[model samples]
Target chain A: MTEDVPVKVNGLNHWFGKGEARKQALFDVNLKVAGGSLTVLVGPSGSGKTTLLTLAGCLRDVQHGSIRLLGQELNGAHSDLQRALRRRLGFIFQAHNLHGSLTALQNVLMGLQVHGRSDPVLQAKAARHILTLLGLGDRMDYLPDNLSGGQKQRVAVARALVGNPDIVFADEPTAALDRESGATVVQMLKRLGQVRGTTTVMVTHDNRILELADRIVTLEDGRIVNDTAP
Target chain B: MSLLLQALFGRLPIGWLQLTHNRTRFAAALAGVAFANVLVFVQLGIMNSMATATLKPYGFFQADIMISASDANSMTEGSNVARQWMYQAMADPDVVAGTGLFVATVTWQRTDKALGLTTYGIDPTQPIFLSPEMATRAATLQLPNSGILDRFTRGLPRDETAAIRPQSPLSFEANNITLTLYDTFAGGGGFGGDGFMMVSDQTFLQQFPARSSGAPDHILLQVAAGADPDVVAARLRDLVSDKSLRIRSYAQAAAEDLSYQQTKRPTGIIFGFGVVIGVLVGIVIVYQVLSTDVADHLSEYATFKAIGYGQGFFLSVVFEQALVLGMLGFVPGLAVASLLLWAMASATTLPLAMTAGMAVTVFIGTVVACSLSGAIATRRLVAADPADLF
Candidate 1:
């Protein structure tokens, strides 16, 4: 509940298939993520880093053990509770899954719209404000089809942060960006953690991002092999 | 458009935005829906016109009540009742006049186009016609081998129908006997024939040598002024000792005949199946479009789920798109159908019209039909898991 730990996991396990084709993804994993801190999950392909991130972010059903996210148990929870818990969270995929038909501004507005925001004038204002901060002020009216890869990723970033979620879970948020933009994005997350007490958990293999992480947790073959505080 | 959408749904019209995103697909889907609408409208139009045509001959006669054999089914193709029923019906105080009309279908040769003309043979002596204009025209048929033709008949020579007056008569050979038509009437085509022909009882005998005047196809009775036709009809039923006669008010008999044509005929069944085919075509076309769109945007929908948008939200988007496509397509479909119906009505001289009842029925039917397709298309998106997107 305090700044020491906002995300606590105990002996969490998850599987991918069933019966003869059953396969395990995570096994007896345990960790605590401090509030207002950037925790990075780094691993090679099929190393279970993405699996652990999605499990902790409420993106998948927690199969076994307990995961207390923002003081709420997620294992075997009702769908209503899961959806309510998800509303207070944010997610950024590596592909930047922005709606192709929506403009940059509308895409950001969707972040707030899921929470059933009623005020149109203020919602548009807030959406515009966040897009402007992401250096997409001139591209607010441009559709995703009209934007480049890096620009579309920024729109996705603006969409995730516009709602001011309690915690952000990103899977390679900067993969589609150049060095300067990726550096700017990581700095923005770091600055938000210090100024607004917003927690961020990202899974990435970017070397430049490793230098700025407050803590690094690496997974290999479905188990934590190394944990370090930089 | 936005205001209408806001009234029905919320301010953010996500469905409309997504449907309008791909211009080519939207246009194609709209056209498909419109084509289906046209198919349905045309079928319903023809079916409705048949209902109206079946009752056309009833308006030509001037009877307050009619008597036919109890086993009779419709105006045409029914057993002929004994002519003694006319005298028995006239015994009532409300019975002012009566007539024995002989009706039968016969083929007439026009030197170019053969016509199936329903012959209504009367004495031309009783008050048997509703309009004085028709009565005046029928009076000319009293002469031997003389008759009047229906100008409103389909496929009739336009100038010939107009020129064949008393001064300019036209002769036609039919049933191996030549008859000359010296006048015309306003009666149109119906289920019995392509047109109507007025003849004397003697001429009707010549047309059908075996049909005796002792029995007529129907008995028409004219009740006294300010008297209830229903009351006189009921009295006739009791006074007539014949159990084979079916006495009914003029309006009631025509209504029963129309219903009989709509429900118990081969043409009715064909039109009903035609309507079913049209609806099925519409559902299949809309399903293809909506299912394809859902497949293309699977990842985006999964992202919405990751963002906590529920299954209900996705349903609304697809349903909204369906409603928009159906309504837009119906507008053009209605316009095109009305024009075609107008042209058909003019050529056939039937009471084919675009009514408000018909429009409202099609509008509601299309909406419900398209929504069913939309519901089916969303089943795949419901199964898409957010975990798979990572």
Candidate 2:
């Protein structure tokens, strides 16, 4: 599990616009995420935590840094290469972002569909298995609108993990859930990271789940202020 | 390939479901598309109806060959030919039978009622090439003072008994023509309103005092079996050396009639412009609706991208949605246009024929518009960053 870095960002700096409009979103950020570990990034509002997470997730263009996930450099990748790289990375957001028209099971199956996998039976089976693991077995047929907030987040988590990506990036996934549901989601994410041996990076403002993370990184302004392993 | 199929077909149901889920938005979009179709189809139907009405009178002339002046492009602008031409045509060995006819617009009055009517002068004794039904009508007609009034004008009483006020002075130089009713020809109206009369040459000259020299407008000829109409037409052309006189077979006349309608009448041009406007409106509406929907669900698209959905998959969804909306709107629009055409047929003398070709053309046009709009609107999805979901 400790053999190599799952995500590496070298002197990453990102700014929005130029001149007077220029504002640094990420500043001289350098970090390494070890494989098969649950890393939590905690920060206050406007701390540029999301910017750093987006850069590491290959969702944004780097202005003055190098970013590599699973040893593939994303600094100058073409559009197609970037898409391929994105297919190998799973992302979860504060909102479920589940297709309101699709059922929970279908939402999970969409993960495989995004990767251009068309085997519906296999996809369905994997989706069901993931939902069951996430304690959402009974809600598979419910649409996002029909499910409770906690169930919606769980479905989103299942969607992220269903693709079997090398790394999972979650941005405030538990922000919209109650305390108990948030804890359950964090615990489930941690368990999946350990069992699947996949790197998990979750950005959150909730400190209650800090003990559940294998490592905690705090962000102040746009730089990492503290890194602690427990 | 399977992935594309699944995304195209499988995602289609979801897209439709989403559309249906939002009843208000879906209805608005459907209404916009349907209105566009209605506008296009109605304009086309009216154009067809006008063309049909203009050509209805000639439908009965079954002669394989006809000769008229080259400048007489349509029924409205035909030129006069001498009765001697019919006799000259009959001299050909291949000529079976021929007749001389004159068509003109004339003002008629009985008592006080006066109106303009299309008047056809034909020799009733000869085997005229006109429809048998019209011939029967011509045979049964009673010419008052030697002039026969068509069924359209027959409702008016004779000049002696009628009490209606005349819009024009009643003039009967040689004889007074009494009105008589007969069977009506469908869509027989000419450039003017739907009132026409048929009469003998002598009665026509009597009723129309302005025609000091009576002349037939055209010659109708019937070729004997095994006789080539082209050869007879050529001979007629050679005999009539004056450039003002040109010979045309019935086929040539029909072709010329179509060309005249296509070029001279504003019906085709106006309707063509209508169709273009409909297509443009459809594209704009479709683009706006689909673009809004895509923007509303942009996050979901990003999530799909994050999970690995290809750009092709996103594009397929947009296309499927467009097709669904187009089809949904098309069926109702066609039905509405057909209803309007039927209602119009009853109220007016125009003949509106909605053919399968028209339907096919309209459907193809709608589909193309929708597809183009969807393709343009989905460009944002292609440039979207999947990692934005994080």
Candidate 3:
């Protein structure tokens, strides 16, 4: 692996439960993601795709091997280090996870605020710019409850991108959108990654998203079965 | 609220957002806090009333120092101190004048109800009343079997007030003791008695034939100009070899009586427990609201954790909510308690005012209670695992 790779995973393993119920979730997973590459983890259920994504994102403890995110090793990383590293990353979960009491613009701003402090005016401007890019310019003040399912999912995507993170981890990013909105969000993610050198590692089953990926790593039963760049 | 929180922390008030999102839950939580505040305020007010009532009789005198029987626990309940103590106190150069005070709680029958009339028996010659009007009015007790009644007594009827004036005396029989009310005063009712009446030493002895003139319940003495009452009292304590008498400055006696009533009386103990119960109820209610809220958004909290939000940020939100509930709830609770206390003071003639000290204490207590509940409620949320959010 090159020294400049943004995400480098070597000999990674994971397990769940204890004693008689203990079961392995991943087996010696190894991968290197270059800067600005859109790498899609494609696998069936229980294939440990999410487990690898979380380990690489520094979202969980690395139980067995070495995983470096943004040149810092994740194994035995202190909480302050993990937290500082997390500030440079973004995430899009399947559930959208928008705060019900906050408006669309506020939810998007939360993405930027985790980095400590910034100009509130600039933060709002950046959030508005991102929300508008996702075709939610008019719904910026609407709470999550008032938004439709597709609108909420688009807002989540906007939040993950508004902070201008160096890297983004997404799970089923376009699962709730219609074809037009879905295509728009996918195009935005691709443009941001390619032009701005924002690395993206996503666990997705969307065929359109997979086709546009710079690299695809397929997994079955916790081990990578295929890797191709085409 | 969001704007206010933003101003304070310059960050998203996640706690305020979560609380306000569910309108019903927030209102219920606030109401719980308010109820607790009201409970504390009212109990404190009742305790205040106990002290006020216990020291009511002390207000009737202008003495710099007082001598009571050692058996006296409060101003109202005591046996007798000999009149010779008064004569002994008057001899000192610091002592100008003194009076022997005889007290007896007599049961008076008012048609269907029985009331306690605390009758003060005093010498017509010596002055002890704080009120100049009362001192003049008390002189009328010099007339045979005549006395002055407390017009502000709790159960005194409207018709009796009109009938018992200085010009028109109302003759009545209390416990087969003949007494004619020639005047009235402003000393209100208290826990010690439903009313009070003053009489001459001769009339008082006639009313209680078994009692003697040599021994009175208490002795009140006035000190000379610019002399400290405590110093005079100390001098008297040294001069009087009687170990069975309690000698102190009048102010010290009243202060001790107030504390004794508040700490040692059954009313004080029961009201103190009321305050504790109120705090506990408040904690439970707030905890239920906050805990349910945390549970409902477990997945979202896990997502926040994954998004690089620290435990401190989350805790800030919950504590902000706690502070909001405490401060806002105290407003309505204090207002209601004030109105109730004022009404009670007039209707029952107990000195039950809502003091500044009581208000400040209850306010701090409310904030602490709500914060404690918030801390307990956030226990599970702080442990939210970002790994399981998927």
What Cα-based lDDT does every candidate model obtain?
0.85, 0.73, 0.84
Clash number for each model: 0, 7, 0
Docking verdict class for candidate 3:
medium
Q: How far is candidate 2 from the true structure (C-alpha RMSD, Å)?
A: 5.6
How does candidate 1 score on lDDT?
0.85
Candidate 1 C-alpha lDDT tens digits along A64-175:
9899988889898787787887777888889999998889998898898898848878989999988888888899999999999999999999888888887889999999
Ranking of predictions according to TM-score: 3, 1, 2
lDDT of 3 by residue, A57-150 (tens): 7788999999999899999999888888887888888889887888999999998888888799999999999999899999999999999999
DockQ per candidate, 2 decimals:
0.65, 0.51, 0.66
Error of 1 at A168 (Å): 1.4
Give the lDDT ranking, best first. 1, 3, 2
Comparing 1 with 2 on TM-score, the higher-scoring candidate is 1
Task: Rate residue B245 of model 3 by lDDT.
Answer: 85
lDDT of 2 by residue, A1-230 (tens): 23269789898888987899999877888889988888988888878888888877777777788988788787887768777777777788887889887889988887776665467788889999989987888989998999988889889888888888878889988887888878877887777677777788988877777878889888888888998996
Candidate 3 lDDT tens digits, B250-329 = 99989988877777878777887887888898888777877887888787777778878898887777788888888888
Error of 2 at A182 (Å): 2.6
Model 2, stretches more than 4 Å misplaced? Answer: A1-4, A224-228, B1-8, B64-71, B78-99, B106-117, B125-128, B135-176, B179-191, B195-203, B212-214, B221-239, B244-249, B379-390
